[model samples]
Target chain A: MARASVTRLTGRPLLSRRQDGLALRRAMPDRLLPALVAAMTFLAALALAGAVGASLLAQRWNNGAAAIMTIQVPDADAPAATGAGKRGDAVLAVLSHDPAFAAAIPVDRARLAALLAPWLGGAGGSGTGAPALSLPGVIQARLRPGVDPPADLAARLESAAPGTLAERNQPWTARLVALTRSLQACAALALLVVTGVAVAVVAAATRAGLAARRHSIEIVHGLGAGDGYIAGRFARRTTVLALSGGIIGTILSVPLLLLLCRLGAPFASGAALPPTLPDGDLAAYLSDALARVPLPLWIALPLLPPVSASIGWLTAQFTVRAWLRRLP
Target chain B: MIRLDEIALRYPGRDPNRGAVLQRISADIPSGGFRWVLGASGAGKSSLLRLLSLSLKPTSGQLEVLGVSVNRARRAALARLRRRTGTVFQDLRLLGELSVFDNVALRLRLDGLPEDRIELEVTEMLRFVGLGRKLDVRPHSLSGGEQQRVAVARAVVHRPPLLLADEPTGALDEKQAIRLISLFEELNQMGSTVLVATHNEALVRRFGHPALVLERGRLVSHG
Candidate 1:
């Protein structure tokens, strides 16, 4: 009869060495505080890195292409008799002839007035006073995604239209680019630091665990349990603690990120909320929903806990084994 | 049965300043018999018990247990033989984290006894040691006398043919000491060979077992 089946039939499975080990573990004192501390420290580091990294990745990939530049050219200088209509025709002709200029959409007068309403103030209704003319003859150029305007593209445009100055509006793009890069670098450094700290903490904890269990290890040797059995127990305990700590740490850190996004909104411009980037959208919308979602906790949080816990458990096992060799 | 013919055990000098704990010594323990080893501290009485327990090997000489020459024994075979002989350590080798029941069950567990059999044997041993009520309690919670009983229970629970105790009753009061002795006597009556190493001359004198007396690492008398 099969051993397991026989046991099930008899209602008492024969005791195996494996069952004895489990029973022994059940009888042993569980050092919860040390185990929990080791776990929490390990977990917190991972959660910190995970949350920041997820946000950075989302921002980099999703909202990455948001800031765009548009240039406007009113119809080419019209005849002095009907300057407005003729200038518009000339501008359209110049845009059609230029190779650097890909797609130029002329904005009508009403739309231009609406676009300038925020800066110029007062809703543009029939009764509203005529707004001060700001650059009457301008051509609007929309650059392709990721395509940097050639240095001479601006110069050529100015040359095409006398008394017109070509501006790239480079300040906002430069600032956004700098902000994204800075966040990425900061996230990377934070993760590295967390990993280093977890390793050190686990190593110290392993050493302490070995010291406390020295007598038990010797007892194990005396009982004829070899290095493998002894090591297995320590490894099991450490690994469980690390995984638990990781879960708790992840739970704690994600909400902080959501709060930070909320605090930062007033300072950030509407342009910062770019539609072309999904990450930007996530940062904007998911920050609130995921503020409690804890997605990054699940993703980036296991980095150091397993490594640290494994190292700690292994160190304790090998050290005790080496000590046992000197006992007899 | 254990035979150490012309066995010479030594602790190698770590430096010129340090000396060997045991010099070469020869002895034999007959099968299914009881032997008591006597010596003062530093006389290597514990060392001899360690050798017999197979916890230590002779620096030189032939060592055999159960007719198998241990010098020629493979590590796996050595472990197997060691598991068959239970030792009661002088320091009382009880895992403090484990309950008294589990500690006693360890020997049977090592021998791969069935769980039901292990429980039955552990219960019987605890009853014999007067720790039946303390089965679920840990060693640290027990008094020294009670702890020594737990250790004795652990050693004899598996019914190893050879049982070696090093100062098994050192911490017990006179009454408890007598009880511990009677426990060993009961094991000896059950066909298990017993060797006890102790400096307690009064107990040995009263018990009247054949003695192996060691003086300065040498076997000075056998009676």
Candidate 2:
């Protein structure tokens, strides 16, 4: 309410132009120094985890359509000995007639046999042996694209095929989803713990500064400077510390995260493919998802460190302001 | 101009019966004059200063400073009033962390004076107080007399219309007290109203000035 001119409290300005760099350096000892290394390590871990979790969720969400399971039913007259012919007919009848099954397009024998060629060794392996040994009777039906298979769909299919068992591919997908969520929660918890520690450290340092400068405040008051002027100095100092510490902490965490990500690349690469894609070429799976993922992570992963730093700065500012209000 | 009419003050204590520290007592110190309020320990001299300085409001009377009715003034107006005056504490409240030059420059700077002006004015004041050589030295490193002078320099730096000094030379030798009192006289000559609360009778006789004496929370005499 007091629209007075902005008063400078001393010959020294609140923030010097060129001296900001020097001030930032000075801030390191008081604010940034202690938390710098820890903050970096914590933030890097947080960012990497966040990137990984987000990527996993996005990958799962994006790849919702790719979770395919096929049951191949053998030909009607292949033989009655393996019970393959009867089961194959039964599957065809259910898929075509059951209203619950919107459309199940059966693949031709040649295509199904071709699909299995790589795993069963189509012809002869260079000096290895013949490809086909024995084959199981299975009905491969491609469910209507983009339609979610219901929980009871498997039961219905099993009932339809009297002697056949139905298998759903979603349980493994659900497990992967749960793991991603758990990792995200763990990262979030660690970030919170680091934030708490940062605030506590800054608060303690500020209190010590206040105690040392108690006479400075009293003298200013005695010289007719009010509470606002005294508080302004403290708020400015701590804020600088918070921001600088954040920057330093973030800088430190990046390289550490890169190293860890590099080390974990092999395991993550293996996870991108299904066991059914039995060629097992590491390069193929690497190309399948890893390439798509790193870009998203690279773009989004760098944001966490700065965000953590801002949290630190904000906490320090509020704490100092609250402490100053108690002064007479 | 400072006026306290039928003023009363009290501090929270162990006993409730002794409610008011200074009962309904009225006093005034006119503008452009020096007034030495003489009182022994616990005689409420400092309480009067507190009331005049707008540090504490009187419980039961109207008070004014520089023709502004402080009792009815807004918080902003009161702060303006406070800024227009300066008080040197009995404890010589100089910011020990800052150098002597900085301590003196504080008041002017708070009023938003430019850096060059602050530098010139602070230099002049430090010179006047004979601490020019020790400009960059912090107060805690200074001697008792030098520290008291720095406190004086800070109080008078802004050249406020009103000045309050509580035992300004309480820790000084007789010669130093005389020099300090002369500075106060010079300020008064320049039209700043001066009020000194002291018990130093020898110093009072040394520099003959009008005096107001207090005893047992009551005004004993005025001259």
Candidate 3:
């Protein structure tokens, strides 16, 4: 009879028959493989999320750093003819004329005092009822893109307002950028290591599976099944296991990633809270920290499952083929 | 059809002085020919079948099956050649987890036959072997005789041109053995070249087929 006739006669699809005929996998149960894969995928997703979050945070820091320029007007203590405030006004006026400066605003004495309030003992004045400390007049400037010849601008500003110092914010910005880059590199390296571990875990599991099913494999081989056929079975099985595990791991990691961001939120947004607290209250400390990451970083989290599934599939295929070659 | 010339098979790590399993062995099996291979225990009958099945390569010498040189053929070609030959192992080798029908249908499936055709042929073959009612039963659930029949049905279900049975009747009673041998005879009558290896010399004599006898892994007589 023609092969198609059997399907028609049985009223079953070819795929069902093919699956039913695969007695080897049924003969061997894989209880640990899926769990291992899931755990690996979970760790991998977390690492990937960390890398993406670092990248977004770094970009934000770079943008903020690039636009800022600070000018310090040292207090003269005389408070009379051409004081620090006049010098600050002169610097702002000079910056306003240059196309390179987007905006130049003076920092008021009150705002400066508030910034130094903690160090100066209190918000109103010194704690011992002494007069409030005199602070320098500062100018905050925003520079336009591609107009960052800070040295020339600083020299011009210094000449325009004597006793004033023009400081380009680029040096500190460069250092912060370098630090973020290093963090990103570390996250990426962690992700690579996790992926390698995942592959190794899957490979080891596949080898164990092969050893367990050696008898059935020999029967199939003796029955004329090719190595490709055997390897394809293993690949499909491992891929399914890995895909399920990856989905589970990815799902489980979302809340963890969110909690991480929340914990870091206080630092990222520069929100103020008490620096000193009762020791050993970890939960309370974490509760005070909250952070929000960009939506794109969260969106990238879903791709981990498929990537992990593909890795599992390829690892199984390579393992099976290599193992079979060792046999007669 | 099968051909062997000066084929020698030795297990790896064995003493060299012990000699090969089948040293300088040579034989020819013609198309549609039925032959019985007689030998004592450890006479290398299974090893000879392994060579014919393309599961093992001769250490040195020439072998061919279905007109393809085993040593010279590519791996894919050898697989194709194997597909054209059916073997009933001494151990039966029935997958314990699969149903009897699935065990028989595996051969046809490996040939890429459609589901409907596999079901039809497997059912018909099972019925022919008196196993029509045990289609969904696993091999381990069946009696030893029933499992042997399942193995036989599996081997011949694909209608291969050559069929090899290694001690297929070892687990059968006198009546069951006779029935199984008749099944082999019926298949041979249908133009399949059949080879049966057995220790039952009386049955061999009564069936009156051409016989090849082996002693200590050497072909002693062939007629």
Candidate 4:
């Protein structure tokens, strides 16, 4: 046995200070287990972000993109076969009157020409540079919730003009929704695995602590220390360590989360990406990206320390109590 | 006070024939009575003291310590019973990590004594054991006789109603042995039931107390 300093021992205020007689500071060290927990927390943070992001994306796509139905009326300026009004007018009247369609707005000619200018020459579509060629009219229609587009919509429009196509992106939107749901499920599974691994890590660490302090524990037990007293020493030590690990992991996840937010910025805000800058604008980008991390994630990330501490405390309590059962 | 009626302890996973270390042994010690546990090596003296101190549950039969039945008592009830008892092991099981003061204070701390009371009691006990100046020193820094006194101080610091000592004077000289026995005698006179196990017949004859002698895990005589 190495000799310890007498003066240091005497300097302690009372014998009550090291009430943890098992010397858990020496038995269960503060380093390795927290590091493992920190790694687990980091993965957990990523999984949480994925789950939240997938859910938000699904909701936005469902409400905005999925409900929109576009109907294109080509040769739009031609007279109606009913010979009463223009072909585009006939189609617009049918969509606006239908209760199944919530709203419809016809895209005017100038904006339509500018939109088609990319495929046709700019002068050919604009009447200013040359005689304007016939261009399809686009009407972005919104479908009412749980309502299907009438199958006869294109047929009714064709009565007015030979070819007017009603195109709905519903199939593609459905596929995207399915994809995001599975992504959320996968993220949820990852969270479960990380949580399990953390519990196991804490359990293994606690068992090792018990083994290291076996003789001291038995001696203390012989001194009439109850099972609660022994288990409390371990549980308190492990909880502090786990909390430290969770804090470290949360701090480490910040940069990663920020990067993911930046990558996802355009889709979330429905804003166009900024043209390339020399990163003098990086601070602005960073601030914007930080804001994009959901409120729920902000709330959830800070809670990791407490959550992990709870896990560590409960696991250590159960483990130590069960281990003490082997004693007399 | 202690009472044993056919108490037996069998540690499992040993040589099958030698496994039952103490078998159907019986004895009764009145309150404040002193007894010298006499046995040759492998004669189960330690095991008997172990049972008396509530360190081992008897494999079968009855043991009543401090008027509480050992086998039938709940774990918490047994713990409360154990706090009333103290034992000085042969190996001097002092926690090497703690100072002498802390070591002696451990029992009172377990009893939830107030901080000032624990300090006062531990200091007084260490001084009584003649280790007052070495209160802050670790057990390993003490000599063998000093360590033995420290163990004795810790065991009796709580002033338990029951005290058991096993080979307490094994490493002590004749004078030190007499001094240790005198301390036990004083504690016994103070109304503690003290039991000492020893292999020293000369010391036993010198002290001249009743002896419960054992041979091969069986009590041969009590005279």
lDDT, candidates in the order shown: 0.65, 0.64, 0.77, 0.85
How does chain A of every candidate compare to the true chain A by TM-score?
A: 0.60, 0.59, 0.80, 0.83
Query: DockQ of candidates 1 onward, in order?
Result: 0.22, 0.20, 0.43, 0.40
- Steric clash pairs (candidate 4): none
| lDDT-sorted candidate list, best first | 4, 3, 1, 2
lDDT of 1 by residue, A1-328 (tens): 3556544533443543233223323322345424554445544554454445445444543333332335555334444222434545545565556555456666666766676677665544312765445435545664555566667655554554544444454565556656656765665676566655655554555556656666666676676665556556665665565555555555455555455444443333222432323566655566453443345544544554555455546654665455556644
lDDT of 4 by residue, B1-223 (tens): 5788997788767687756888788888899988999989989999888888777788888999989998888878887887888889888888988888888888998898876677777777888778989988889999998999888998899888899999888878888888888888988899998889999888898888888888888888875
Local distance difference test, candidate 2? 0.64
TM-score of each: 0.63, 0.69, 0.86, 0.87
lDDT of 2 by residue, B18-104 (tens): 567677676677899788989889888888887777767677777878899977986556667777997877787666546777777
The candidates, ranked best first by TM-score, are 4, 3, 2, 1
DockQ pick, better of 2 and 3: 3
Across A206-232, the per-residue lDDT of candidate 4 in tens digits comes to 999999999889888888888888888
- Candidate 3: residue A223 lDDT (0-100): 83
- Which residue pairs of candidate 2 clash? A40-A249, A71-A139, A71-A140, A72-A138, A72-A139, A72-A140, A73-A138, A73-A139
Q: Say which prediction, candidate 1 or candidate 3, comes out ahead on TM-score.
A: 3
Candidate 3 regions exceeding 4 Å error are A1-31, A75-85, A122-132, A265-291, B72-74, B173-182, B185-191, B206-209, B221-223
Across residues A90-178, which tens digit of lDDT does each residue of candidate 2 receive? Answer: 66676667444445555555655566776655542322443344343455444444555567665655654544544446577667766
